[model samples]
Target: MTSYVPEYLKAKNRKTVFDLFLRDPELSRAEIVQRTRMSFPTASKAVDFLISRGIVTEIGSEEPVGRPGRRRRSLRFNPSAYAALALNFEGRVLEVGLVDLAGQLLQYEQHAFDCFHQTENYAQLAPMLQAVVEKSPCHVLGVGIGMPADIDNNAETVALYYDRQEVVVPLKDLFGDLLQALQLQAFYGNDVNLACLGEASLRGGAGEKMNLCYLTLGTGFGAGIMNNGAIWLGGHGRAGEIGNTHLGAFDLKGPLQTQIEPLETRINLQALEKAFGINLLDDTVLPQDTQDQMVEFLLPALVTAVYNFSFLFDMDQFVMSGAIPNRLPGLAACTEREVNRLLAYRKRSVTISRPVSAHCTLIGAANAVFEGTILSELQG
Candidate 1:
């Protein structure tokens, strides 16, 4: 007799099968069953569903070199079935990329604004985006936007700092017409959060249950938390806004007592440049003494931030990115040493490292869009 399976279980099994297929170039039904520990019938059903939906394809049988007679039919993920568009909005630059279902970049472009005022009209770049979408090699699944700011509750607006002023731009309203015309789903998220996702993707999607934090030390300071393979957008989607957290004592009697200086004010690239009189972005190399001095000045605040985050979230690993860390060679090791000194008494330790790729934010935006659209649909 056939066993009765609930719809939720079927959906979960489909997702598992699909995820496995994505991880591996090819898989057989028997292999899927062996890997997932699912019944052969369930695995077969999921494979059949995926094949029917054009998400997967069955190639010819393959025989292992060692095993002579054991020929298994191979199934491969169909990369051409869907595509995603990723847009990363930094302070004054916008980077766009087209990615396939398998997270391969098909095309990429970057646009830099001459001034802050030019970014007010988000729709100004719509024509360029539309041209890319029309030329996509496959069906466009969705668009993902990674903003260098906090997105509001409605997912319709983002609050970004530009020219020493905070501006709220209507995200959905800006892209509404373009998305409607393409009939594509759109997702907006913090750029750092997407960078964390991109870093996780570099690990081949193996950091699902791990508590990973992506700390960015750039023009402004922020962090992205990834727990159990998902972006941990805490209550109100502002979990990684560590820039606003105060690190020093407050003045009880002063009018600005409640408005203590935030951690970002002391450790960002601007602060470093102000303190050392050296532009971090410039190609001119600094003397050993200057580099050491800069490291000494930046290390304490970074260590303090790491300690606070590790203590609060019990982080397993910290991935450092952004303008400063990428520019300074040894920043990661120095930060790690400081964190080690601070957490020496504790039984647990958190690891610190740098990003695997320079295009982490852009790749992450694409991955987020693909996962949010394709994986979400499968799981749902």
Candidate 2:
């Protein structure tokens, strides 16, 4: 970590050049030196390192602005220089995608399976993922999977949630064949956390500091927090368990030992179905008042979470994702209005809404690979 260390200096210089290309997408050695205040030789060495790694490309040259005679070779960050295979298992189907260094989802597909056929899940997606890795046209960074489960970073495993319960499994063990065959790194996390990270990347998180929170309501409620542009994973990587946070309690269920209930018990789809006597997720039923009823039922719980997150984190943006908000427009709008009103009283501004892209989890899984690999040097 010392400045006098040669490796440290070299890594630092390469990072500086890498960041420059990210900002401008194209830069000559002269331009890099001028903007970075580094000497010509230092910039050249850094650019050379990136080029050798295939991350920097010489895309010809052009006179930039006023320098008419200064037509030097232009170098750009090659976004497709490395790729990550991203897979999202949303309980039933696996949403697979291929992503490049630039955070773009280059390819995507889905493979459906029965909840009971859990053993066949990863094994089934192997071919599709293998095909993606083979055709990636660039070095494979790794494979990152987002699933409804608890992730153990140290253990390199996940306890996947499916068929209404969690089954402990090492994700790498599931994809061991493909991973070993392709010689790729493996990354995985809770689907909601990945979604939050994905949203941050889309919002230019790479270049700035941000405190953002993402909330999703489904059969299970969850929250993902990004503080200062980095995921706020608590010591155990389980910080955003807002679902288990208590917003309210009632003695109606039991007067003695089990009277209290967590917010998730009330905010999830089962609560909605129990109150409405219909499956909210089932699209066949056309109940005219379904949306209205859903909005009212979820408003209080949603307000509680948003209010707490906004007040505690001081984050201005909240992306409330998941099928509930995406399918029911009224619910998203109501959550926004109610949460904003509470925050306005404290002179704090916040925007509560849905994710801009549907492929958020997929993209975020890919970003995890980049964070661990290509961006790791710059981050340090």
Candidate 3:
């Protein structure tokens, strides 16, 4: 049964119609009315408002109607309605991209980093970013930056615990000048979480009716949970901090450090070098063939975390994303096998699977811009 939708929600419905048009430029008025579940008059009113505001346009007519009274007109969102900037502010580099509401990357620029975390670090990043955005062809809606820490979106600030470490200084203030200099509104979020959102929205999971958990395994690890249809950012925006949670203690100086240490410290490219005298980066090696060792080492510790998360969140599907190659295949299969092994010996059965890709966080961050832009219209 459909519940009553409030007037405010109806206004939101209008934006949803715009989003549908943006996602599918060939949608008809009748299709919008049917998909959005609003009255034909209400849907037409929304379309009229959008067209009047220059946010929507009648692209062309649909195919000849076989059994209809009249042909329907196809509607599309104005690609030039607004623009957005997306950045993946990783510890090693800054990836900047200019995109429209349709998630098209019209332009992009990448900047290498000499420093990992410093107060004055982003100063250099500002000019490089401003240069790219300044050349964009659309009215820039805002800039979304992906970082490695938890953010308080409401206060527009990074949280307390994240600012304590010298390696990861206060980031909110540093990003302010870059955003202000470009005259763009800036939003910050955890990189892994952003990547998950991107993957869920842009790729294979778009229309899937299921819960998704994107786990990024790279220099660090984090989980992005999408339940129902929206990203599940916990009450304080820290629900996805699975990497920080301690699974257990390992000897720092022991040879087993590479095996029992945390997944981030164990599976990363650098950690592999410190453990097994080989550099995947320098060797120009494919992660698939070389990452099995790291995965074999870190699988147990990760399983504990995954099982605990399942117990806490009751989620069944898991995705292993982020940049490690051979790591995911063995890691995912091992994690699933272990979980199932443990579960089989216990009470109930469970099903688990690996992520679609390692770059889910990066893609998820991109989708964040798409999701935010379309949803912002509803807020207005």
Candidate 4:
């Protein structure tokens, strides 16, 4: 006969066991009990519950170290039990990926758009998303959309595209019917914010507790802020708009005609390319003089942003990513030197590094779905 367990206790035990499997990949019932310090009966019940829910699976067994008479059955977190569809909208390209619960990308495809003539063609997203969901290897949990737009997370609406062209898109309204048809929930977030989450996922425990900022230097500039493993969306979910922060005045024509420019105008890929007259996308190495000039123009603004972010959040690290920073070698080291120089008063220097993976935004979108749906389901 099976003993009854309270629903709350069961949920808590399930989370504990699930977290262990996530960290260790595989564990036996004995190991789960030993690591989580739960009674054997409780651990068995939790594992049984997880197996029933298809979250954990019993695979082949391992023999005990001393007895070596019988094998102990191993339980593994079944990453293939569920999948998520991730979409990243980067100016003219829409990248779609099907990712497993383990944050592994199973399939990917890119769709291009003519921004000038085909701005309204974003409606194609539904069929594309539906096709990917149908092709998922497991039960599709939900969809996560990351775009370069000011998102009102509460309403799931795109307040503005910042590119100065696309219309105000109510993303939930555009995708609501599709979500209903597929019977899956939808999540919306800024592309950079999702990228930060992706980067954080790569770090695991180190990232979980650290205050991190993911700054992207591309056609435009933006940042994703993470506070103690959670994405820190401000009062309106617009907290990481570092690109819009105004720097001091500059003499555009002369001292008489000074002008104020945001960080984007002076430090982004477009500005760097225009300043150096070199096409970064062409994959040619920047001339030393060009690199020096680009660094000179960017270092000050970057230092200022880092300085402000450091004081505001007591940030532990800054991750530099996106097109310009990724392509430009030595950018992170250069920026780090500049920031360290400016922050001489601090006892310890801030850590700055590049992303581990190029497809960070796509991975982050999938991660959002996993955390929101799977983790919530486990806890709920």
Highest-lDDT candidate? 1
Overall local distance difference test of candidate 4: 0.76
In the range 1-380, model 2's lDDT, one tens digit per residue, is 13557766776567566656656777788888898788988889888878877889898977767656767888877988888889887877778889876678888888775433336644555666788888887877888878776787767666665665777676566667756665678787888899998887766544335678888888888988897657877765677888878765556656734655678998887887788776767776545587787788788877888788777887778888887676677777787788778777677767877787898898899988876776555422
TM match of model 3 to true structure: 0.76
Q: How well does candidate 4 score on lDDT at residue 108?
A: 92
Q: Provide the global lDDT of candidate 3 against the true structure.
A: 0.65
List runs of model 4 lying over 4 Å from the truth: 1-22, 28-49, 60-73, 114-119, 161-169, 177-183, 205-210, 249-260, 378-380
TM-score of each: 0.86, 0.81, 0.76, 0.81
- Colliding pairs, model 1: 208-228, 208-229
| Higher-ranked by TM-score: 1 or 4 | 1
Error of 4 at 189 (Å): 1.0
The C-alpha stretches of model 2 lying farther than 4 A from their native spots are 1-48, 60-75, 114-121, 160-173, 249-257, 284-289, 377-380
List per-prediction Cα lDDT, in the order shown: 0.78, 0.76, 0.65, 0.76
Q: Give the C-alpha miss distance for residue 17 in model 2, angstroms.
A: 6.5
Q: Tell me the lDDT of model 4 at 115.
A: 35
TM-score of 1: 0.86
Instruction: List RMSD in Å for every model shown.
Output: 4.2, 4.4, 5.5, 5.7
Candidate 1 error regions (>4 Å): 1-12, 62-71, 114-119, 153-155, 161-170, 181-183, 251-259, 378-380
Model 2, CA-based lDDT: 0.76
lDDT-wise, the better of 1 and 4 is 1
